[model samples]
Every structure is written in structure tokens, then in C-alpha cells.
Target chain A: GAGVSQSPSNKVTEKGKDVELRCDPISGHTALYWYRQSLGQGLEFLIYFQGNSAPDKSGLPSDRFSAERTGGSVSTLTIQRTQQEDSAVYLCASSLGRANYEQYFGPGTRLTVT
Target chain B: AQTVTQSQPEMSVQEAETVTLSCTYDTSESDYYLFWYKQPPSRQMILVIRQEAYKQQNATENRFSVNFQKAAKSFSLKISDSQLGDAAMYFCASKGPSGTYKYIFGTGTRLKVLA
Candidate 1:
């Protein structure tokens, strides 16, 4: 539990169903990031939250994808009407605000949409 | 936009032997950072080594070291005395120290240690 913790290590859901993934960042870390890693593909940035000063949602793939961080700690990524293509390993990472600081990552949530 | 590229999809090395994983990136920024991360079966993203653009000296961490060529925009990870425990997927990433600080990762190279 010293590292970033993610909930629902694995999730299997049907298409058109909604799913929510959670992330608990390391204590005192102010920056949290979301990324998706599809099979054979590099990790894709999703969203970024830094001390709750308006999250950088620029990486959200579509309007249906959104995320929020409360208390500058725990965060959730929601996917509405999920599609098969949305299946991937959702990774959460946290880092100190200082640039060049290493980012600590969670085990990630494996999502499968059928 | 910044991009990282790992040309090798897979690589193998005999136990105790040395191996190198190649990585390249495209970035116009003059200042930034490059990193190599290892993901074992446990799925933890561990930082193997890092190099700063401003520093001309390379970085070494135990059995892991990096060969950073700033002008060529290449950062390669060299593993010495490879161990079976070293078998994992290694990712090369880059991020500008300023601005968004969003890391751009490569596809990764799957490393295997033959015992």
C-alpha cells in the first residue's frame, strides 16, 4: 500500500455497459495520471490531475470518457457505454510536482469489454 | 508533440551476458528527461535508469545503465550480467521537464534471459 493502489484489478463487462476504475495515489503526491495500454500498443495518456486545479482532460479519447480527483487523492475514471475497443489495462501513476521526478505506478486495472 | 520509439519488439540474452535495448525519440524541446522503465510479470513499473538532457554524463544504476545520445536523440539501456529475474518488458519514455510533464512511452521491448 505504499505505492499507488488501484481498485477492481480486473473487470469483465458487456458492451454498452458503463465501468468505473479507481485510483489511490501515494500519500503527499500531488500529481496523478491515467493511461491506457492496449495489446501491442504503447501507453496512451488519458487524463491528468494536479492538486485539483482543473484536471487536464486533453487526453480523454472521447466525450464519453471522463475522470475526477477529489481531495487531491483518490480518483476515478468513468467510461460510459463502453465499447470493445475500450478494453485495455488502465494504469494510474503519481509523481511529485517537481519536473524530472519519477512517477510511481499502480498495478493497473485490466478491463475487458465483451 | 513528443514521441518515443523502441525498434526491437523482443530481445534475448544468456544469463550473465550483456544485452542492450534500443530506443529513439523525436522532440524539438531543448530540455527534457529520458527514462527506462521495467515491467516484470508482477506488473510493477520500476524505474531502471534515467538521464537528463542538460547533463552530458550517462546514468548507471547497479546492473542497469543508459547510453544517452542527445544529438542523435537515442537512449539505449544496457543490462549487464542479465539474470532470469530481469526478463520483462522494458519501456523507454520521455517528457519535458516543464509544461504538461506527460510522459510519452514507446511500445516496449520484451526481454528474455536464457538460463
Candidate 2:
């Protein structure tokens, strides 16, 4: 419970279905980030939320992939019309939002699209 | 655009021996930081080591150390006293002064420790 936590450690969904993955960052950590780890693509940044500032969605692959952090704490990543390629380990991390601060990660959610 | 590259796709080391995983990057920011993370079959991304570009000294965490060459834009992870637990996928990442502070990660190198 001390480190970042995620719900539904494993998720299996059918193609064209929608799935929402949740993440709860460490308390007082203002910077929260989402990353996807695929077989060959390695770790890819998905989105980041820092304090109350606007989230940087530049890493999002498409409009179908979106995320939002509420109350600057819990966040959810939603994939609409999930495809087989959307299957991957979704990781969540939290940092102090300061310069050169290291990120603390959670046990990622394994997503499988059939 | 910031990019990170890992030329070594796989590496192997005998137990108690040493191994090095190579990484390179291209960034326009004057100030940046580099990090190494390990992901095992468990799928947890654990931070291994971090090196700041401003520091000339490389970072060392017990058996895990890094060779940081700022001029060459190279960051390599060196694992000493390799153990079975050290077998995992190592990723080299860089975060520039791009306001968002998003990391650019390499394709990663799979390291296997032999008994």
C-alpha cells in the first residue's frame, strides 16, 4: 500500500471492447506517468499528469487512448475499441515532480485483447 | 525529438562475472538526466541507477553501475557479480528539459545470467 498501486492486475478483453485501467499514485507525489511495455516496443510513455497543470498527452498513440487524473491522485487509462495491439503491461509511476527526481513504479496491469 | 538506442539485443554472463549493456541517445536539451530500469517476468519496472548529465561522475548502486559519457551521449549499465536474479530486461532512458520531463526509452537488452 505504500508504493503505487493498480487495480485488476490482469485484464482480458475482446477486441472492440473498452477497458479502463486504474492507478493510485503515492501520496504527495505530484507527477504521475503511464507507460506501456510491449513485446518488442519496450517501454513507451503514454501520458503524464503533473499537479494541476494540463496533462501532456503527446505520448498517447491515438484518440482512442486517453487518461485523466482526478483530485491529482487517482488516474485511469481508458482504451476505446481495444485492438490486439493494445495488449501490453500498463505501468504507472509517481515522482516528486522536481528536477531529476526518480520515479517510483507500481506493479503494472497486464492487458490482453483477444 | 529525444531518442534512445540500445544496440545490444541480448547478453549473457556467467554467475559472479561482469557484464555491460550499451545505450546511446540523442537530445537537444543542455541539461538532462539518464536512468536505467530493470523489468523481469513479473512486469514491474524497477529503477536501477540514474546519472545526471551535469555530473562527470558515473552512478553506482551496489553491483549496478553506469558508465556515463556526456560528450558522446552514451550511457551503459555495468552489472558486477552477476546472479540469477540479475537476469532481466534492462532499459536505458533519458529525460531532457522538455518541460513535460517524459522519458525516451531504448528498445532494451535482455540479459541472461548463466549458472
Candidate 3:
């Protein structure tokens, strides 16, 4: 009955550092996605993972952004050499096999790159 | 590429009144899904309603309803008997039937419900 969840609701890091955001999807959900929300940009899809298939990294702005889902459940989005432009809310969502089902979202992590 | 548009950046409605938030999208695909998500101050995205492109009939969820016009690529949300709790940011999103689980979201509309 639990919904999607994310850790470190807020994170503050200096520029050039690396930061990792975690996401815990709902049980039985095989599809997970990561999106970034900023003041300038609305909500932009970052990556998507379905079961054990290769994740969709097409939306990654640069090579610095990467994500991994361990055991097909928990996902971690890592940003290398974080820049001030990376400051935004990182949101994670999950759905039931990525069909017509609705995707449930998490509270999100507000990352501040100073 | 699919694009969702919410022209109204903000809107207000008195309690128990009705308000309609406009949304339009551009997509070459004929079959897709349109959704309305609400985000409160807590910033949690909540699904309000959804419409299937193939479904001619509109979708309704209690006080929340959607006017889906496939010809115009328009999907607007109508809230009746508005309540204070309705104050939140409403986002319009579209997902293509291309088997990719990506959703394109609009800039969102901030709705303020007044008593």
C-alpha cells in the first residue's frame, strides 16, 4: 500500500562535487523513471528503467548524469561534477510495467549546488 | 516529439464555484494518454484525471472532469464546487503510445482557491 519514496528530501552540495539521489518504488512496480524540476525548466525526464532492460538515458543532459537500479527495485541517480545549473528537485516515479497505468511520484529531493 | 502546453500560468476561483484550466498538446501520434497532475505546497505530484485519445467520452472523477478534444489536441480540466484544498499547481502531461514511458509535462498552472 506504500507509494513511491525518495531519500534525502533536501541535499546541499558544493560545485564540482558528486551527489546521489535515491528512489524506492512501489512493490510490484517494474518501471521506474527519474525527472528533474527546475525554475527555468519544467519537468524533464532524465532516465527510465524497466525490469532488467537497459535504462533509457536519452534525456540525460550530459555524460555527468547516470542512474542505476539495483535488484530491479531501488534506483540511485548520481550526478558527477555537479554544477549550479544542476540545482533542482529530483523526482522519481514508478508504474506497473509502463503500460496505460498511471505513474506514481515521490516527494523528490531538492538538490542545491552551491 | 510530443509537447504539452498550459497557457494560463495562474488562475483563481471562489469556493463552490467552477473553474476550467486550459491545456493543449502537439503530437503526431493519434493514440496517447493525457493527464492532469496536482502539486501542492509539499510538491508531491498527484494524479487528478486522465484521458485516452481513443476515448471520445470525457473522463470524470467526482468533482474533477476533463474535456478532451482530440481534433484540437486540447485537454482541459474542469473543477466544480471548488474547495480550498484545490489550491495547487496543475500540470498537463502527455504520453505517447510509442512504448516509451516518458511523459512530456507543461509548465503548469497555479490555481488559487479563495473563500
Candidate 4:
């Protein structure tokens, strides 16, 4: 079953532009996550990938936020300069490891940042 | 610093009646895990029931159930029969077995299934 998948379901960049959101975990799911749901931040937790060692970026929220997961499933968060409080809704989850094992979401990427 | 608390932002029930969504959390770690996510409106974050803070017995899923009160860190969600597609937004999460498993959401509660 193709469960998690996220892409440009909706994106509208502008302010300082720099956006790239994509995730596709659900083939072997070794845990992958990235969340951000603003409206004053309701769902936070911005980076975590397990299986390629070195991810848990500590809820990335700075360094302009970055992510990568190539060859291990496909993930790419990257939000360099976009602001407007970064708009919101860029969720992507996948799990089967990494501590908890019940995450499977993707239908997000509503970033606006205008 | 785990913290999740949904003080009911909005709620209504009647599609078949039975609703209760309240969650509280502030973990200090005790081997934890508790969730109840369901964000429809196409937001997609569904996983409607889970609790394993050592499991005291209170996680159901047929009609959804949870009332795990692990020493007052209460986790409630009992929606039975209520369905208007069950309305949406109902997060309440908390994860803490540590090891890069972060999650602590709960400022959601919009559930309106009145029919």
C-alpha cells in the first residue's frame, strides 16, 4: 500500500523564496518524520529520519531548516528563506522504528509563505 | 519537556451520541506513549487510539476508547457511534520512550458531528 506521500499538494512561495517539500516513505519505513502545522504552532517536530543514521536534527527550526533522506525512502524538507512565519502545514510522517511505531501520514504541504 | 493538553477547543456530538475528548500530559518519563490523532479535513494524521504507558488496560479501537489516567496525566477520548464522518481535528499525543521519538501535540479538539 502506498501510504505516505507528500509533495506540492499546495504551495505558494514568495517571501524570500526557497521551498522544497517532499516525502514518500512507506516501502520499508524505517521511520521518517517532519511536522509543522502553524496557527501558532500546533504540531511541531521538524526532522527525524532513522536508518541512514544522523537525522534527528532536534526538531529543526533554524539553520533555515533542512532535511534529506535520499535512497532510503525519499524525503526533502528544505525551507530556506521563506517566511510569513513560514505559513504552515508541511507534515510528513512514516514510522516502523525510531521509538514509536504508529505514524503514517502525508497529505500535507499547504505552505503559503506569501 | 513533554507536554500535551487539549482543553477542548470545540466539540459537539450527536450523530449517534457519545463524545468525550480531553487529554492532559506533562510527562517526566515512565516509559511512555499515548496518542489519539485524527485530523480529517484532509489534513491526514489518523491513528485513532494508542496507549502503552506500561498498559494498565484502556485502549480500545472498535469505536475508539481511551481513558488511560496514568497517575493523572489523563488521556481521554471515547467516541462511540458518533459519526458524521466523525468531524475532524482531534490530536492528543505524547511520546517519550526517548531516542529521537518526539511528539507532544494537543491544542486540537474541533469535533463536530451533529446530525
Candidate 5:
């Protein structure tokens, strides 16, 4: 089976610029999630989508961060006006559903705000 | 809100030895799931083991096992006969029951295997 995949393994951008990270979840996966991991820090939850229900944006750090899951298969995380503090590895994961199932993670996109 | 904690920043164990990584979480929900994820230098997260709060028996996979104490809110991973490939960052995570399946992860513990 194909695993979760992310694009632009490494991204370098200037401060205040916007960046869009893409994620392709496994086939038939109905749950997708985005998280950020800073150096020496834990994985910070960003957003989550379950089936066609409303996406959970409670973990979004700010309004500048947003995500959209199109057709319930792919998801894109956009960071508008990125700041230096936003430099980290953006990870995406997908699951079959809820039900305490294991979440498969992608390689992640390392965003560097210079 | 739920929180996961890994008290050890790093740990080292010799090959073929045993090592345990400690994890604790704070959550009001009684029924949830605890997981141990391993991230190697390649930066890919892999599911190591999982324990359901409702089950009293611990979860074990090959040489990897978990000592889950629901009452104390503690979940520790024990690796017996550790191998070099086991060297990686171990993270403890918790997923609340139903609703959104977002995972709350710990700070992670770096494990080093020595020959």
C-alpha cells in the first residue's frame, strides 16, 4: 500500500513570505492531520480533518495558518506571512478513520524562514 | 486539554541489553489510546506499539512492549535485547476518545545504542 507523501522536502523562504505545503494521504484514508515540529520540541498539532465533517482548527497557532483538504484525499497547509519562528518540519499524517487506529506519517517538509 | 510528557531527554543502552523510556500524560478522558512512535534519523515516524486504556493487559510487539498504568497516567516502553536499529527518537502520544483524532505527543526521548 502507498504511504502518505509530502512535497518540497525542503523549503527556504524569506520572512513575511507565504508558503504552501502539500500532503497526499494514503488511498481510502478518511482522516488527515497536520503538525509542526520545532527543534528540540514536540510535535505541535495544527489541524485535522475527518471525512467531510468540519475541520478542527483549534490547534492553528494563528489566523495566518490555514489548511484545506480537497475531495477528502489531499490536504494543503498554507502559512501566510511566515515568520522566523515558523521554521520547522511540517508533518502530515492520515488514518483509516478514528477508532484508535495508527496514523501513518509522511516524510515532512522542512520550512526555513530566513 | 491533554498533555504528554517524556521526562528523559536521552538514554543510551548497550546492544542486547534492556532499556525503558518513561512517559506520562494528563487527560480527563478515561477511555483513550496511548502510542509509542519511533522517528529515526530519516525523519519518518513509525508506530512502535499501542495500548488501549480500557484494556488492562499491556501491548507487546516482538522485543518492544509497554507497561501501561492507567491509574498513574504512566506509559513506559521497554525494549528488550535492544539492537542498533532501535536507536531513534521515541515519542509518547495520546489520542482522546472519539471526536477529533488529533494526537498529543511528548517531547520525545533520544535513544542511543552502544556496542
Candidate 6:
């Protein structure tokens, strides 16, 4: 009955540092996704993981953004060498399958790079 | 290229009234899906309604309904009996049929409900 959940609702880090955001998808959900939400902007796709298949990293803005889902459940998105432009909300979502029409979203982590 | 557009950045409606949020999208795939998601101050994306490309009939969910114009590549959300709780940011998204379910989202429309 629980929905998707993310940790560190808010995170503040200095420039050039590294930070990791966590996401716990719904039970039995085999598909997970990450997105970035800049202030006053739309949601930008980040990365995706579906079952045991290779994750889709095309949406990732740069090599600094990487994510991995272990045991097919929890996912962690790590941002290396954070910059001020990285200040945004990181959102995670999950669906029953990779092509499932509907996706359930998490509360999101508000990351701030100073 | 797949793209969703929300022309209206903001809209206002009185309580118990009706308001329509416009959305249009362009894609090469004929078999696709459109969705409307609401995001309140809580920042959680909640599905409001969805429409399948093959379905000629509009999709309705309680007070929420969509006008799906396939030819025009438009899917607009019409909210009736608007309530204060319905006030939030509405986003229009479109996704292809296969490969991945990643959706192309619009900039979003901020709806303000006046009591």
C-alpha cells in the first residue's frame, strides 16, 4: 500500500562535492526512473532501470550523473562534482513494467549546491 | 522527436466553476498515450487522467476529463466543479508505445483556484 519513497528530502552541499540520492520503489515494481526538476522548469529525465536489463542512461545530463538499482528495488543516484547548476529537485518514479502507461512518483529530494 | 506543449503558464478559476487547461503534443508514433499529472506544493506527481491514442472517446475521472483530439495532436484537461484542493501545477505528458515508458513532459500550467 505504500507509494514510492525517496530519502534526504533536502540536501545542501558545496560545489565540487559529491552527493547521493536514494529511492525506494513500490513493492514488486520492476521499473524505476529518475528525473530532475529545476526551479520554474519542467521535469528532465535522468536515468531508467527496468528489471535485469541495462539501464537507460541517455537522459542523463552528463557523466557526473549515475544511478544504480541493486536487487531490483532500491536505487541511488549519485552526482559527482556537483555544481551550482545542479541545484534542483531530484524525483524518482516507478511503474509495474518498463512500458507501463502510468507511473507512481516519489516526494523527491531538493538538492542545493552552493 | 516527441514533444508536449502547455501554452498557458498560469490560469485562474473560481470555486465550483469550470476551467480547461490546454495541451498539445507532436510525435511520429501514432500509437501513444497522453497524461495529465498534478503537482501540489508537496511536489508529488499525481496522475489526474490519461487518454489512449486509439480510443476515440475521451477519458474521464470524476470531475476531471480530457478532450483528446488525435488529429490535432492535442489533449486538454477540463476540470468541472473546481475546488480549492484542485489548485496545483498541471503537467501534460506524452509517451510512445514501446521501448521505454519515458514520457516527454511540458513546462506545466499553474492553476489557481479562487474561493
> What are the per-residue Cα lDDT tens digits for candidate 6 across B4-84?
999999999999999999999999997888999999999999999988898999999999999999999889999999999
TM-score for model 3? 0.97
- Tell me what TM-score chain A of model 1 achieves: 0.96
Candidate with more favorable, higher TM-score: 2 or 4: 2
Compose the digit string of candidate 2's lDDT tens values, residues B1-115: 8999999999999999999999999998888889999988787789999988888999999999999988898999999999999999999998886354788889999999999
Docking class of 5: medium
Give the clash total for candidate 4. Answer: 0
Model 4, docking class: acceptable
Estimate, for each residue in B41-114, the C-alpha lDDT of model 4 and write its tens digit.
Answer: 98988888888899899989899999898989899999988979989988999888846477889879889997
lDDT of 1 at A74: 95
**Candidate numbers sorted by lDDT from highest down:** 5, 6, 3, 1, 2, 4
Candidate 3: segments with Cα more than 4 A from true spot: none
Candidate 2 lDDT over residue span A30-103, tens digit each: 99999998877778999999999999998899999999999999999999999999999999999989663788
Predicted candidate 3 versus true structure: per-residue lDDT over B68-115, tens digit per residue = 989999999999999999999999999988475789999999999999
* Tens-digit per-residue lDDT, A13-96, candidate 1: 999999999999999999999999998878899988887578888899999899989888999999999999999999999998
Arrange candidates by DockQ, descending: 5, 6, 3, 1, 2, 4
TM, chain A, every candidate: 0.96, 0.96, 0.96, 0.33, 0.98, 0.97
CAPRI docking class of candidate 2: medium
Model number 3 iRMSD: 1.8
Output the worst ten-in-a-row residue range by lDDT, candidate 1 chain A.
Answer: A94-103
Candidate 6: regions farther than 4 A off: none
In model 5, the number of clashes is: 0
The CA root-mean-square deviation of candidate 2, after full C-alpha superposition on the true structure, stands at 1.4
What lDDT would each prediction earn against the true structure?
A: 0.92, 0.91, 0.93, 0.87, 0.94, 0.94
TM-score, structure 1 vs. true: 0.97
Model 5 spans with C-alpha error above 4 angstroms: none
Q: Which pairs of residues collide in model 6?
A: none
- All candidates' TM-scores? 0.97, 0.96, 0.97, 0.34, 0.97, 0.98
Native contacts present in candidate 2, fraction? 0.68
Summarize candidate 4's per-residue lDDT along A1-114 as a digit string, tens digits. 789989989999899989998989899888888989986347888888888788878878789989999988998999898889888888999888855568898988899877
